[model samples]
Target: MVGRLVIVTGGESGIGAACAQAFGAERARVAVYYHSDKDGADRTADAVVRAGGEAMTVQADVDDEASVDHAFTTVEQRWGVADVLVNSAGLNMSGVTVREMTLAQWQRLLDTDLTGAFLTSRRFLNGRGDRTGDAAILHISSIHAYAVRAGGADYCAAKGGLSNLVETLAIEEAPRGIRVNAIEPGMILTPMNAKAQEDPVYRRTLEQNIPMGRAGHASEVADLAVFLASDQARYITGARIVIDGGLSLMQALGA
Candidate 1:
C-alpha cells in the first residue's frame, strides 16, 4: 500500500481509527474523515503519521451531500484520488421497539448508516473519474443485516440495504476495476459497545454467546480491512466478510 491514498470515514474513533492506522502502517496516505470528533480525527491522523504514513483529518457529515463532496474535494486537492474507501461511520441500534420508535430516530440511523454510505461511495467514485486501477470500497456493515434483533429495526434494515448496495456496486464497477465489499462484524468491543468495554462481567455475559468466547477488537477488524485493501485480496469483491468470532452462528441456538 506504499504511496496509495486511502479514505476512512469515522476515522475519529473505534474501528475507523484502527483501520486508518493499519493502512498507515502500510505507508498509505490516509484521509481521516470525522463527523463530530475533530480531536479524535486529529489523533487518528497523528497515529497514521507515527505509523510511517502521511495523513490529514477532514470534517465530513456523511449524511450530508455537501459535506461529503467537500471532504472528498479536500482529500483530492491534498493527496489526489483515494485508492481505498472505508465507510465505517455509523450508529449503533437505537434499541427501541418499532412500535415505540420515532420517525426521526429511524431516519437518523438510516441517514447515517445507509444513505451516508451511498453519498460517500458516490463522492469517492466521482473523485475517481475514469481511473480506477486497484481501487476498493469497503462498507462496515453488521451481522445484524441478516441476524435480526427485536429492537434493531432501523439498524438491521439499513445494514441489509447496504449489503445489496455493495453487491450492486461491485457488479456495476467491476469493469472499471473497482471493488466493493462489506465487513460485517458482531459483538465487537468498540465504543458502540461501551457497556461491554466498561463492565467485564457484562462483556463476559455477551461473549458467552460467541463461539470464540470473546469480543472482537477494533484492531482485529482493522487488520481485515488492511488485507481487503491490499493486493492480496485483489479478486475479492461483493463479498461480505464476517469477523465476529462466530457470534452470528449462535443466534439460532436454543430456539
Candidate 2:
C-alpha cells in the first residue's frame, strides 16, 4: 500500500480509527474522514503519521450528498484520486421495536447507514472519472444485515440494504477494476459497544453467547479490512465476509 491514497470514513474512532492506523502501517496515504469530531480526527491523523503514512483529516456527514462530495473533492484536489475507500460511517441499532420506532428514528439511521454508502460510493467513482486500477471500496457492515434482531429494525434494515448495494456496485464497477465488498462484524469492542467495553459483568454475559468466548476488537476487524482492500483480495468482490467470532452462527439457537 505504499504511496496509495486511502480514504476511511468515520475514521475518528472505533474500527475506522484502527483501519486508518493499519493502512498507515502499510505506508498508505490515509485521509481520515470524520463528522463533528475534529479532535478525534486529529488524533487519528497523528497516529497515522506515527505509523509511517501521510495523513489528512476531512470532515463529512456521510448521509448528506453535499458533505460527502465535498469531502471526496477535498481529497482529490490534494491527492489526484483515492486508491481506496473504507465506508465505516454509520449508526448503531436504535434498540427500539418496529412498532415503537418513529419515522424520524428510522429515517435517521437509513440516511446514515444506507444512503451514506450510496452517496460516498457514487462520489468516489465520479472522482476517479474513467481512471481506475486496483482500487477498492469496503463497507463496514454488520452481521445484523442478515441475522435479524428484534430491536434493530433500523440498523438491520440499513445493513441488509447495504448488502444488495455492495453486490450491485461490484458488478457495475468490476470492469473498472474496482472491487466492492462488505465486512460484517459482531459485538466488536468499539465506542458503539461502550456498555460492553465498560461493564465486564455485562460483557461477560454477552461474551458467553459467542463461541469464541469473547467479543471482537476493532483492530481485529481492521486487519481484515486491510486484507480485503489489498492486492491479495484482488479477485474478491461482492462478497460479505463475516468476522463475528461465531456469534452470528448461533442466531438460530433455541429456534
Indicate which candidate wins on lDDT.
2
For model 2, residues 1-255, the per-residue Cα lDDT tens digits are 999999999999999999999999999999999999999999999999999999999999999999998999899889879989999999999998999999999999999999999999999998888986899999999999999989999999999999999999999999999999999999999999999999999999999999999999999999999999999999999999999889999977887
Q: lDDT per residue, candidate 1, 173-246, as tens digits? A: 99999999999999888889999999999989999999999999999999999999888999999999999999
* CA lDDT, candidate 1, residue 243: 91
The C-alpha RMSD in Å for every predicted model, in order, reads 0.6, 0.7
Tell me the deviation in Å of residue 197 in model 2.
Answer: 0.6
Candidate 1: lDDT of 207?
90
Worst 10 residues of 2 by lDDT: 124-133
> For model 1, where is the 10-residue window of minimal lDDT?
246-255
Clashing pairs for predicted structure model 1, backbone only: none
